[model samples]
Target: MTVPLSRPAIPVLEAGMPAPDFTLQATPDQNITLSELRGAPVVIAFYPADWSPVCGDELGLFNAALAELRRLGAQLIAISVDSAWSHTAYATQRKLHFPLLSDFEPKGEVARSYGVYRAKEGVCERALFVLDGNGIVRWAYVSPITVNPGVDGILGALEQMNNSTQQDTP
Candidate 1:
């Protein structure tokens, strides 16, 4: 006999809106909020968990593309329901330099705010939100439970947004 398995649905965050602000604890008790990075674009990636296989590969892609992301004048942040200790351990193991914020206590508060929390799974789905310098969400993507987001797609969207802003100025 065999049984079928199911995964929770992926949630979506709409574009062209203000991203919900959150002050999650990162490594060493440091706090991160959307408002602090007001002058540069920010990419917030919400993944299921720290030690999971897909989560590991997704974060690794970001780590490997750090230089490119920086050159685009953007900062990358990964959020999960894991505790700071877990995030620290994962970052160390993966050699990931970017901040991985912890949403552990309330257990998916930030994820729910961002509309990415999978209540049944007790974690967030693979979601990406790109907020402009002023904290306005410029683009968003939500991947299926079994699919991974395209890193290049995110970078490309950022590039397009950057270009459009420049054109609008003069």
Candidate 2:
């Protein structure tokens, strides 16, 4: 008889921690490295799948809010366990302006690092993280699997970051 090894649960990342760096395929031929996006605020949205209803709505909401996100000086990138080909198709069909990075090869590697991977579901929890220009997490939120975490929280976090930056300036 053999006993099965259990994988430990990963703690969800929180504010004030350094955001994990990763390089994920954005398209079949292009990859985006998190570290390279430094010097500008980054918004990472991790959803369960690319084309599911909730995921679609959540990403579509983000897509429509791109201008506002840009005004806050933040770049948004969505992540999922879907393959690069799937992401490319989905992004094109949805007409999303932001990059949809694939966490597929290792299957949720980036999500696990961010503490958002859902093992049983084989997907990522609906989670969001706002990283400051230096790559420190400014805000983090994990919504229920069935929920669509709207953009208000992300915008608020960026606004708060902006305010703090101004306050810190002499």
Off by over 4 Å in 2: 1-8
Candidate 1 lDDT over 36-151, as tens digits, reads 88899999999988888888889999999999999899999999999999999899999999999999989988888888888877988788988998888888888886677869
- Give per-model TM-scores: 0.92, 0.94
Determine the backbone clash count of candidate 1: 0
Error of 2 at 157 (Å): 0.3
lDDT of 2 by residue, 55-132 (tens): 999999999999999999999999999999999999999999999999997988899999898887789889999999
What RMSD does each model have against the real structure? 2.4, 3.9
Global local distance difference test of model 1: 0.86
> What local lDDT does model 1 show for residue 133?
89
Which stretches in model 1 have alpha-carbon errors above 4 Å? 1-11
Q: List clashing residue pairs in candidate 1.
A: none
Worst 10 residues of 2 by lDDT: 2-11
- Give the candidate number with the greatest lDDT: 2
Task: Give lDDT for model 2.
Answer: 0.92
TM-score of 1: 0.92
